[model samples]
Target: MTRPPLLEIQDLRTYFYSRAKEAFIRSVDGVSLAIAPGETLGVVGESGSGKSVTALSILGLVGGNPGVITGAVHFAGGNGASGPRNLLADLERYVSLTKHDGRIVAVAKDEPGWRAHVERALARVRGKQIAMIFQNPKSSLNPFVTVGQQISEAVRLHTGVTHASEAKERALGWLERVRMDSPRLRFDQYPDGLSGGMCQRAMIAMALASEPSLLIADEPTTGLDATIQSRIVALLAELKSEFGVTTLLITHDIRVVSRLADTVAVMYGATVMEHGPARDVLAPGVEPKHPYTSALLASLPSTQTNGRRHAVDGRLPVIRGEVVDTMNVPRGCRFHARCDRITDAIRARCMGEEPALATVAAGHRMRCHLHPGEARGG
Candidate 1:
């Protein structure tokens, strides 16, 4: 039987105003995604593709002027009393916008009112129902507090473990569960004392300690040694099997996504270009692929050809153009500028209008002119 999504993001648009450019930086524009219970959904894209912003928007953590102008993050992981709740409930009341040529030119937001409303809407949801392990564990973790204490606090806050001693014991257990060397000794150590890998493990332990229904891991393996990166991925894979926690993993590494994700969403220029089951979407020579997705997969170092590893001949294929600048996104398909598969027949449509995410196969969707006239919906 098919299960409903634990978290669903619909038409999520998070924009930030840049005074120097005097325009809205569309960090996340019209992003829609979903994660079913116990399924890992990996969002892969380049550095500026709005993966992190999408995760932050889900947690109501987007700060700055006119943040999160429009969106509906419907979470179905709440207690039975309330069936499902929109994390961005009543958001329209707090902000007004001025547009010129269909672009947001000015924004007037009641910052205080919006902040209060968001706080109220996410009061019992953020940490308890959806937890996040942010990038850069050293910075995310408190340097002043011991790792154990920090984890204990999260456990107490989310898990209803009121007793400090019990929480501390639970925290220690989690550290051990994450395979921390000398869990007892490491528990009292501050984040600064640990290696990058160890710190990441601590961060993971703390996030999992709360047993949140949905876990958002933003760039979980970034800024670590290659060996450590593999270990962290391995650990995460193990934990996913053990805990079966629904996760939204945001990263640029396709290898990591291939290993961990059941479904994949390929984002570019602040929007999803392709989304589907990982096996089909990441398969080499897969048909009906968006040009951006094909380019990304082609850039990989090596691939198995006929069940044997072969290095790509000559230099690796590089996407010819620079990453899309979200500040001044083009009129047509966001990827049309960099796309290499634009035939003369589709060139006009690719340059004139953005294609909707159209279903091209069972459980697969693509946003490209190549797959024209399919059902227009994610």
Candidate 2:
């Protein structure tokens, strides 16, 4: 049986005003995704494809004028809650918009009022119910405090281990759990004392110390050495198996997604192009895939050999054309400008109107005119 989604995002839109451009940068435009209980959903895309922005929007962390204009992030609490709570409840009351030719031209937002409401709504939920591990471990960590103390603070705050001695013990236990070498020595060390890999391990330990029901790992393996990245991935794999914590992993690395995610969402031009089970969506030479997904998979440096992947000889295939610009997204398919598979039959439709995310196969969805007959709402 299919389980109810633990985190459901419906038509989320996050925009940032650019004074020089005299317009809003649609960082995350009309994105919808869901993660079931104990499932890890990996969102993969290019650098400017809005992967990180979607993660930030989910936690209500987007900043700037008129941010998060519309959306619903429904999170099902793990503490015996009756149903999923809409984190963006009553959002329309604080913002007004002016539309010109069916496009947003101006926005008036009560920033102060909205901020206060968000804080109130997420007071008991942000760190306790959902924890996030940001990309930069050193920058995210407190520079002035010892790593162990920082983790102990989180343990005390969320896990009810109030006593200093007990909290410290629990913090040490987490350090050991993350496989930190010389746990005692590392406990007293500050952020600067640890290597990039070790700091990442510490960050992971701190995030899991709270035992949050949902973990959002945004580019967790980024900015690390290749060897360190593999180790971090391995550790995360182990932790996922041990804890069974539901996760939303955002990254540009297909390898990381292949290793960690049970399901995948491919984002482009600030929107999802395809979403489905990892095995099907990431499979090489797979049919019925969106042009964007096929291009991404084709760009990989490895090829299948004897049922295993190995490095190839020649230069990797490159997807022609630049990534879509979000400031002025195209009217039709977001990837139409760069798509290589547009046929004569679908050319007009692919250029005239945006295609909805339609079912192409069981448990698989794609947004392209090629699958017009299966059109359905995202």
Candidate 3:
């Protein structure tokens, strides 16, 4: 029997208001995604492609004046007993069991009723539902404090361990669990002193101290050597298995996606260009419908391609002319300005008529004007 998904994010839109244009920045546009319980869903895209923003939106984290976010991120918490059940059986019961991670920071825009949902969603992730490890550990960790204290803070918040000493012991155990050598001593070390790999490990430990149900890692291996990157990834994979934690991995590396993702969402600019089981979405097979997906895969370095990397034709189209406004959106596909595979009519549709998400196969979907029939069939 198929297991029910842990989280389903539908029609998420996060726009940032700016004086640069008449509209908001439209950083996240509209995106839909889902992650099954215990499954790793990888989100891949270039910098500024709204990959992390999508993750942020799921947690209701976007903030500040001139920002508008509207979406529903529903969670069917993992059955307390562990294995799977049909989510439809008692979705409300499952939802009632959810807990949000509170420690993850959010940048929220001022909007009506935003505070209530933000607080409610965060309550789930703060210590129970989700935790996040960002791309840059150097900036993420505090230089002045020892790593153990930071972890201890999270442990205390989530677990409410009243005694400082007990928190210390648990924090030490977390370091050891992350495979830090001399964990007890390492606990005394500040973020500035740890090696790149160790800093990431510390960040990972801090994130998991609350025993979160889900983990969102945003390029946690960035700025590290390949070997170090592997170690961090391996460490995250280990913790996920050990704790049965669901993970949402965000990175631009297809190889990383192949390594960690069961399902993949390929995003461009601010929209999901292609999504499916990782293999199918990453396949170089014929009949790949999205031109951008094909181009990304082709661009991967391959010795079989005679050492000549395939460059997607044309430069990445800048939102064009100047930074785009987010307060008000232009009519049509947010991607129309940059898409290469679009027919003239499609381009016309893309520019004037926004397309909704369409399913091409079970568990696979794309958003384009060209696939409306499939949307109905799916």
Candidate 4:
């Protein structure tokens, strides 16, 4: 029997609300995608294109008063004993404690064995089943704590290891796995002492210590030198194959996506403009259906026009005409303003109609009015 996709996100919109302005800043608007078991899905975009927000939304980190997240992030993987299970069906069970009116409240739902259910579900999933590697290792790691201690804490928390020695040994083993030299020596070192690359390796070691089924890597190579970046990406590729871990790689670097991702999703202005196999989407001599995707490709340093490198004309659009406010996104195609391929014939349609994500090729999806029919495989 075939297994279900590891993670499925549908109609996901994460909007940040400002009571004073009474507006919702759409950080991630109506994004949908899926990652199969052991498959890598790359989300690429400019700095403010909501790639990190999408990852945060999936991990249930986009909740609280500042942000309102709507949609489903169904992660289907657990223990592997009972096949895959939908972990998001009722997340309320994971809420053993919630704050109410500035007071902490313990809610057991007044049902039989409710607390047990919440504890069991919370322990079985989340950090144990799905792990995330955030960008900027220095920020992600606690400065006060030793790297080994942090990794040990995570291992102990997720694996329920009682002995500190056991956790330390496991942490040391993971440090070695990430190819950190002298794992034993670095185990007790503080984050301040390690270089950026070593810090990233430690972050990776901590993230993979739990052996999560789904690994969400958010710009794993950020703040690193070019040589170190290549090494980290190669390490991720090697580890993924070794552990059979499915990945959701979120990065602004298209080069990183092209190197590591099997499938790629191009994001612009809080939405995905195109998604397909990375080879077809980013390969040489291939034209993408979405104008936004094409513009991004043209902006790449590799793109050449008569021996000179090609660069995209025009500046990136500022949503809502303000630096802080991203709520007032333009109607219709978000890319129409900066699009180089727009024609007078379709200008009205591009400006007035919101295009749905349409299939333009086998396994390739594009959000554009120019391609409105069913997709055919190459």
Q: What is the C-alpha RMSD of each candidate to the true structure, in Å?
A: 2.4, 2.5, 7.5, 6.6
210 in model 4: Cα distance from truth in Å? 0.4
Q: State the C-alpha lDDT per candidate.
A: 0.87, 0.87, 0.70, 0.76
> Residue-pair clashes per candidate, as listed?
0, 0, 29, 0
lDDT of 3 by residue, 41-104 (tens): 9998777778888877666565644343455666665335554322122222212211234211
TM-score of each: 0.95, 0.94, 0.78, 0.83
TM-score of 1: 0.95
Tens digits of per-residue lDDT, candidate 1, 167-220, equal 999999999989999999999999999999999999999998988999999999
Candidate 2, lDDT over the whole model: 0.87
Per-residue lDDT of 45-121 in model 2, one digit per residue for the tens?
99999999999888789885878988899999659567999999888899887889776778888988998999898
Q: Candidate 4 at 142: error in angstroms? A: 1.3
Which pairs clash inside model 4? none
What local lDDT does model 3 show for residue 276?
82
| Model 3, position 138: C-alpha lDDT score | 72
Runs in model 4 with CA error above 4 Å?
Answer: 1-3, 80-123, 303-325, 375-378
List model 4 lDDT by residue over 1-378, tens digit each. 044678888777666655664665678878988888988999998888888999887765655443323456777777666654543345444334345653222222323343344346545666788889988888789999999999998899888787999999999999999999999999999999998999999999998898888889999998899899999999998897788689999998888888888889998878888888887787656666577766666566653343322433653332222222246676778877777677899999989887888877777888887877474333
Whose TM-score is higher: candidate 1's or candidate 3's?
A: 1
